[model samples]
Target: MRTFFITALASILTFPVIAGTMDIRVLSDINLSSLIVSPISGQYAIMADGQPVSDSAKANIFQLILEGDSIVMKTLEKKIGKFAKVIFTGVGKNNIIKIKSVVPAGRIRSYDDHLEVSVYAAYMKVINKVDLERYIAGVVEGEAGGVTTNEYYKLQSILCRTYALSNVRRHELEGHQLCDLVHCQYYRGRTTDADIISSTAATKGMVIVDGSLNLITAAFHSNCGGQTVNCEDVWAIPLSYLRSIKDTFCIRQPHAKWKRNISTEDWMSYLALKHKYPVEDSLSFNNAVSFGQAGRAVYFKDKDIKIPLKTIRGDFQLKSTYFSIEQRTDSVLFRGRGYGHGVGLCQEGAMNMTKLGYSFKDILVYYYKGVHLVDLASLEFFREE
Candidate 1:
């Protein structure tokens, strides 16, 4: 969304540090109607509408339901009255809770710090107020599953923290900082993996920043085929740190290559219907069917016609914009390279780099050009100076 890099960078420096606890809406994509809450670790205090309820003491299990504009809070023994909002505050450190959705039938999830339950329209709103590092660990676990090198997790943590800090104001009007979805970051719940936890803790206050000391967008994807693209190519904004670079580490990884086949007739119909391509012209028809890509091109060749590869990717549900078309007998074979947008850091590339004994700093610098890894506190201190 940045227009001019230097001018927009100045505004990002003024964002407040939302440290300590982060308010993230859990099950944000689900239309939850009811849920079961149970504390897993440490002490917890339940309060309704900012007041201590009678059933707050020794309460092991609590049930919450959405009733009109109010939240119906109750325990196994008795009801705790209806209120506009129900709050669950942890007394001390490592206060975890298990939340299992009952209405829509969701999985049981564990969260840290505190929680807030309220009614929003037809669904029950559930927010998890978790500590910063714990949230980052959860995000890493959700985005990058499977046991891998701690170095990769550490790299992921910095990127997640950078993204979170930069976009903290994204959902300010919606009451919470971010959602538990890909819209922000995939944050399922608190991670139990020791390596992930330690990796997150290792990069506690670190983040990637541009030359102006502003936090970068920290964009990442599954794989980049063989080369990462420039920011301007994907989002139409030129960021100095997001320049294109050739990467050999991810070429042999999974999701690096994919293929699909569509009928030549269907492909021609699509071009004619969508772009009003001149199907009658012999040259245009020949070029469309037989196309090759040595490197990534923004447009597919059709003589005088220029079709955006991104548009083709969306229309055909292709993996990436980098693809080549081959004319078969009746079907047009689409050989695609890479998955996702092919911009920023490649996850598989970075993972392989870590396996080769590259540090997180080295991998980050290799992918993101002309960027500096700085502590959040140092940035604030320099801003004041």
Candidate 2:
């Protein structure tokens, strides 16, 4: 299946920005034959874009409706005698809805079930329905709290990319049919709306190439026990973009955030009483450290390639084993553990940036070095024809 470049939804803050096109790898995790939307009632409804549609329509896949818009479906069901929109996408023996999107007749929307699907369909490969319900409830029951920032965006991107890449149809796209999963590396959807397109656009041309600058067959990973893995060692594949380094260790801080009506002391007190920590300074640090850097470690197995660790000032050097955070000067430096997707760019690093003065753009650059910012307009300039 062919994937289109991202739209203005995922990148540009403003909706009216010109568009760009790219290919995304789709995996079996989310395929045209993958979605399992069930109709709430006997009468299932379809949505062309956001408007309502009847049951009878030419619902073939890959029916491109427009450049940026999409044809989505929402089941119209009676709630307490009043109709409510539900996930009832009309399940039958074949368990498929009479989809009426104009994107294509046979193309699917690539949605399934997962936790972070709150922003996108990354949650397609769900383990169980019970887990899926708990996740949705956790996010919706106000347990995880309403998304006030782009954290939802971040989570969704990771999920989508992960799913697409996991079911990679082939290693080099040599014989296997081209895919549309993030695992395949690129991200393009048949018919994505503003938000999805915008997020993808933001990361456009941001292919995770190997050190040789060749498409490295990149795959994003979550917190790596504090030590960032060498691209080649971690995945056993060379990255075309991220270079093999003299040292794999980089100083990253715990992202601090604006007071969520919280305080260091009061928060500690809550932790002590509600969670289970003592209310002493030494105990506090020990408790946090003991629990924080406890059981995580990332190692570069190649003996020849030794990645050194040091403080920003080049004063203190760290050992090869699990490195702990050392309190340095102004920054209270982190000796730290795990690599990308760890705390602060270091997993929680983005949150720390949000706490600090850095915007989302700043966060992306900090982790992805030497990336350039290009307008989606430039990407779509000649393609508009």
Best by TM-score: 1
> What does the lDDT come to for candidate 2?
0.31
- The digit string of per-residue lDDT tens for model 1 on 4-59 reads 44444455466677657788999998889889999888888888888987766768
What lDDT does each candidate get?
0.87, 0.31
Q: TM-score for every candidate vs. truth?
A: 0.95, 0.34
The sequence of per-residue lDDT tens digits that candidate 2 reaches over residues 1-385 is 0122333223323222212211222333432212333322233334433344444233322221121122122223311111112222323332222222221223333322210101123222111111211122222212112232344344334333322322334433432322333334332222224443344445443322212222222233333343444454444454433433221222353221111122345434544564454546584544333322344334311223222222211222322223443332222233444334222223343444555556655554455455433333443452343
**TM-score of candidate 1 relative to the true fold:** 0.95
Cα lDDT for residue 99, candidate 2: 25
**Which 10-residue window of candidate 1 scores lowest in summed lDDT?**
1-10
